[model samples]
Target: MKLKKIGASILAMAMATSMLAGCGEAQTEAPAEAQSTEATETPAAETSAATEEASATTEAKNIEATEITFWHAMNGNLETVLTEITDEFNNSNEYGIKVTLVNQGGYSDLQTKLQASAAADALPDVAQAYNNWLTPYLDKVVHLDDFVANDFDNWDDVVEAYRDECSEFGFVHAVPYNKSTYVLFYNKTMFDELGIEVPKTWADVETAAKTVYDAKGISFIGFDDLAGVVEASLHQNGVDYVDATGALFNNDKGLETFTYLSNLYNNEYARLVGEDGYFSNVLSNQQIASYVGSSAGVSYIKAEGWELGVAPLPGNVNKAANMAGTNIVMFAQDSNKQLAAWEYLKYITSTEAMTKWAVGTGYLPIRQSSYETDEYKAYMAENVCAAACYEQAKDFFFSPTFDASNDIRNTVPGVVEQLVFDKADAQTWLDTLTEQINAQY
Candidate 1:
């Protein structure tokens, strides 16, 4: 069930009124009025050793060697980097918190396992989670604020957008990790040869694509992540996907966006992701001059003979783009293990550690201080184009990701496919989908 304020209040009241029952038992149970957050909010508590009463509340402050399991879907290079960091945390933590990394194959596999584990009440101490996918486990997850709120490297230190993203559960139930924003990967050699400047807006994008396509007689620009592009474009132009009443994108701005992009594709100014699933795979091919994709796709850029340039996402009235990533959530399990997980989270988000993660993977650094650190600045300098995501970081925004968010999000791909591939009248499909979403709501 979707968690509302009242649903969360009882869980909050129970924990606020009680203390930890013991080390390895289920946390102090809340009253029925304080219904546990199942796919609800989350569980949490705090303790300080300065006083006995404070000590009674915050037992996590105690030092204990704890072994915790962390389940994730990261694999390949991403997995290597995360594992490196996990090793660092396990070795460096003063308390004996040994974090065991378990790769649950792809995201689907991880989600499947997490659901089964949640059902069996055999959840790991910590797991990586997406905001939309985390609701059902709310009552089972531990809210991090009360336990780690006052830490120096906690929420306040995170980028404003990331901090807002992690608060989707109405509380700090997750920590921002391995996050990225979209970027325009352009061929500098192609741009220089064509005498086109980097695009500053969607209108500029059309002009640049037309110039390149006209000169080469090949569809020049392809945009990956069609779902995010379309949704973010609407909001950037001051349109909402939905409002209190229903879907709000049936207006002039929405029609204008779809129509504009449709014409761009029909005129052969845009390229679809062709036989290859990702447009990035074809960047080395001469016909493809540029594509807009995730900054993390920097790892996939293989334009051997040409100079690659990265630019912040093309915007409209507002410099807006979507934030894409997952967060690490501590499940409601052993109190000591919860505390160990908190320390590990705190440690990873530290300036040096976050910088290492950002450098190893193409993901953006999560901490404000990480951006200012010498290592990160030097990394961004050598790989100058990689800075585009950070340039548009402040403009990053989230969709209204709540109960019906996934179903709402799923409707966009069909809308995008029709617009890009079939040149369908976007307003018609948008009208249909908006109503469909409202009905689902």
Candidate 2:
């Protein structure tokens, strides 16, 4: 949709003029979209009851604004599905709200646009953002604690890990949307032919990789995300790769984990998905025995005459995996626009909508109940990749988000690159990595 392009001052002035001219107009307040109050636990059904009561009392108030803008990075099939849902909302909502979607090409482009728009006080009513990307807009984004409390009867249905990440600043400010976690994809036919069982632990992974290498004289395991392995491996081994105190991967635990990973790569037991891109083709062609990558990549794994398998990431002291994706961040706006955005968020995240989204995009549904939906169950029966994602959903953890989070995140894989490819000293490279990440603070 073309931007309305009205200056903030002019919009405010027009609102004032309309208010002045409506001195004798009949007035009926709109249904309270959300009651302002401190965050508190309330029965999930209370919100639906409140909306019903509000609707029964009177017609909605006369607000001159009924249109809201949404900005996102979704494209191709993702964009088509999102647009279809929004069109459904526009055609059916009784609130007379029309949501105009503006696709900003890609995530990086969307982030740059959102930053510029926030600086100019022209942010859209809603946009997609990652936890780290939200630092710049905290003051201008709505504190969604009250909205979640008052507007969602099925709020608890949302995944707990996503809930933890959304509550970044003491209260919820964003809602989970496109979410996915790391999973291990393997060649089921190869594993069975080799008499190898699926790995469930980190040590098992090492043995399996080494077993394949010894038997075939070729590295059969590939990790698409080196930094992800570093984080989740260390996390499961009792060390946070990063936290509020900054990078923690240079310690004793880091040494052991880093060394373990370096041996896998340097010894030619595993390969990294560097500039060569994804491991999908390699795994499908039986050039590799297994690979670790995002659950969202399920749709990309075109298995050719080979049975594929997916399972949660192998664990150590604890079973854990890292989550990645965007959430819907509602920018601060007038009550009417905010209400419209809130309802739109609710609509998109509902079990029905999320089921379609997961099947359409390969992203995990944000709600637990979505997995139980008939559509989702049927989809999972056909594709087990999503089922593995759901199995590990409760164990997923997001990194502590800050402006420097992505920079530090980007740096870790670089360290892994040097360790594996350059064959650098593990301790020296880790110490340098730690120092570099610390300097970002």
Which pairs, if any, clash in model 1? 37-139, 39-135, 39-136, 39-137, 39-138, 46-58, 47-58
Q: Write the per-residue lDDT of candidate 1 for residues 248-280, one digit (tens) a residue.
A: 787788888777667777788876775776776
lDDT of each: 0.65, 0.67
Predicted structure 1: clash tally? 7
TM-scores for every predicted model: 0.84, 0.82
TM value for model 2: 0.82
Residue-pair clashes per prediction, in order, are 7, 0
Model 2: per-residue Cα lDDT over 193-305, one tens digit each: 88888999878878888888988876767877666677678877777666546777777888877676767777788886665567766776677898887666655666788
Error of 2 at 81 (Å): 1.3
How close is each model in CA RMSD to the real structure? Answer: 11.6, 14.7
